[model samples]
Target: MSDLSATISPAVRLKGVSKTFGPIQALKPVNLDIAAGTIHALVGQNGAGKSTTLGILAGRISATTGDVEIGGARVDLGDPRRARAAGVVAIYQELTIVPALSAVANVFLGQPLSRGYLLSEGAMQSRFAELAGRLGVSIPTDAEARSLSVADQQTLEILRAIQANARIILFDEPTTALAQPEREALFKVMRDLRAEGHTLIYVSHNLDEVLGISDAITVFRNGSLIETRPTQAWTKAQLVTAMLGEEMGDIYHRRPASRLRDGEPAISVRDIALPGAIGEIGFSVRAGEILGVGGLVGSGRSSLLRALAGLEHRSSGQIEIAGREVAWPRTPRAARALGIALVPEDRKHQGLVLGMTAADNVTLPKLRAIARSGLIDNQLAAEVAADATRAFGFDPKRLFAPVGTLSGGNQQKVLLARWAFDRPKVLLVDEPTRGIDVGAKAEILDALRAFAEEGLAVIMVSSELEEICALADRVIVMSEGRQVDHIDASRAELSVHRILNSAFGVERHHHV
Candidate 1:
């Protein structure tokens, strides 16, 4: 398929596209169009049919009813090979690269460079090099995919798409795992692709990125397109209103310094080290305080939290609770016994059992409380689940439903409820509001604030600087696996810019 010439016809068009799964209508009849060689952005909350629409265009899923056109030519929307042949490709958030294979092998996994019965490895590597040079990215063609960083993996996916000569490319949350520099590089590549007449569809939750890189923006709410406007004409507040149907003031409910107590620390760590990953980290969280951990990806923020939770063994460290000296917890059960609970980053894989019910999952950690003589008391378990659901503002009726059937926000709430049931002295949460909608984000923050208000020390790790500034009573900036700067929220100098500077090791000069 050749690129579409300059014409009045749209590069891609969807007419009355709709999707339904069982009794739930994921997407209503929606119509959209993208002009040739332009960067179009699709913005919406989670579960707003963004993924469903992308799925239809990428030929991964069949639309219930609709018509799709590429370069003014109707194509089979249900056939993956047909879509690829029509110059359509998508890069999803969850990477699809084969871990054990080399980057060259993964780029051409199914379509190999073969001469009769023999494969040409040299030809594949040379082709990948050419594509990487064209895209202005440095990708290791000979390295194994599993050894590459998340940002490099994404770059490899983009190189593969370019190698296929795709005229239209779709990116789903491409920068979610990238740092500032990597994001800029990706944006430059996207602009270069547009300059070369490739239609690009960008989807992301970061409004600032949409304004910076998109030419046109489309907002979706409740499975329907709210509006489409030029990026220059749209504002962040307007986009938030369109996606959420209302004004959402301050998503992170930061508590005042007065609310944070100066009493003895609930949890204290001295000289925490995780071998070569992180070195000599020290911090303390008092009751009724939210201590924020800030850093770029791979800067040891997540590793620090894991080490504190006893999920990762520390080479050397002393952990104390309520002024009592205790040995390093060797297991998660031991950590919990010492009044510590960890909410992991990947909630779906690490937090919840998908096949189990919400009530069962919520009360899992506290089974002993609701059991008698090693027998689970069903009524008592249900009551505990009910109390937890109510405390977190989750629906009680949904407790009986399968955990997998719930939305991302509800699933996150289920995890929080489980940890809250234990009444731990300290809570370690990694990315509490990631991949959740704006409204759900507000609710989760409020729940954490409530927990802190009830005298529970909370340690949170997040990549979003805005989240760290909004929710933390104090922020610890980590760089190269070490804490470099500490900013107290009570002081006016604690801003997102300062946090970013600290993370990047940039020295800021203050006017005397």
Candidate 2:
């Protein structure tokens, strides 16, 4: 362990940390020492105790047996306020910004400046403008937080934490919601924060960011710290091996061209138009083929998926399945009836029921199929959930456990299982492996490949060029709500620069 205790005086420490919920031992006795003014990257597989550790640090929950020390002083952070008072700020993946409120209001939240008792809008706006400029985020103070793009919202949140003058910041998959350029800006902010002597505990699934940003890395496996190593001491392969306990070359198992059966188009879209932005957008997917939807954050990638899944009301468009023509589906159920399932990008909000059990979530989408005599067939639901758990390698003993209790990767698997269990002819999967561990990532990709091998069509949208390149047989690049170019995955060299170039065009590379 290189005597981490001797290397640097810890800004925060967790000694003999142990936490458990019900029958699940979420975290074991963990010892960690985070130094001052350094970005510490925490890496682990899904359900590997990453979030649990962060939760303890944030004071959202307490450890069963352990001591939390800040600045070499023990702190009883019984609540979030105490944690904040102790200079600990956590920016979780599940954003809590109020949609109806302005960015300034959301940022200042309950701690807004006040004269006597009334809120000071003028003071708040001035402070917000100054902070936004400092953060290099161009969010309008008066604009609703929800109206802003994901990148802007994330920036606002970071700025909020900084404004609080938090010395220790915990970023839980903060960049997962951001696009490339936005992520770059956030990285700059992290560097600046480090320069200002702020301690950072960066939690992310993107290994590239971890390699580029972190000074030291900590690996956790199944609720225990594997080891902590300096970033210079490891390579990508070594890190992957450490995280997965195996050698993983060729993370994506790419197949040859999809089986073209004369005239069968697995999925087809014609002249699809949104409320105001997109116009005459058209695309198609073939059996056993993976299509990549590449675009900027608001370039209508998610909207197009919603339109395909019949969740959005398309003004004028024709959708088809199995070469037979079909009009725009009215509801999600209607789309599912035609063997179309969508795994939304924001899985927590749009996909899974957080409070429901894993088994319940897996069976929620296909209740009609699993029901008999106007009642849900419990036995059938259990069988389906069990089969999905086995296939996805999710722990079936935790089937009755709440989806909220599961890690990001397992929750994602439950969502995938819900949709995949339907045996859809065409699957619309968006960001299948966002904010997850490497091991779970491989397993998810394997499931997708297996589905494709069964002649099921898959269309995936992701901001990660590596993931898109790895999974998709064909790539469709979108910008400004337009399909600019469709590249053959076989020809493209699967480089970050190439995919970024294709996504934003040659002119935009300078900005990127």
* lDDT (Cα atoms) of all candidates against the true structure: 0.84, 0.81
User: Deviation in angstroms for 201 in model 2?
Assistant: 1.0
| Per-residue lDDT of candidate 2, residues 169-252 (tens digit) | 999988887767778988998888898899999888778889999998888888888888888887888888888877877776
Q: How accurate is candidate 2 locally (lDDT)?
A: 0.81
All candidates' TM-scores?
0.89, 0.91
Indicate the residue-level lDDT of 189 in model 1. 89
Could you tell me the lDDT of residue 182 within candidate 1? 84
lDDT string, candidate 1, 1-512, tens digits: 11123354788888888998776687888888888888999888766777788888988878999899998888886866777899998988788898999999888877888878999988898898887887788877889999998888888877778778789999988887777888899899899999989999988878899999998888888788788887898999999999999987977555666365679989888888888889768888899998999878889999888887778855568988999989888678888889999999988888899999999999988789999899999998999999988877787877888897676778999999997787899999999987676767788888888888889999999877788787788888888888888777887767888888887878533211
Per-residue error for 479 in candidate 2, Å, reads 2.0
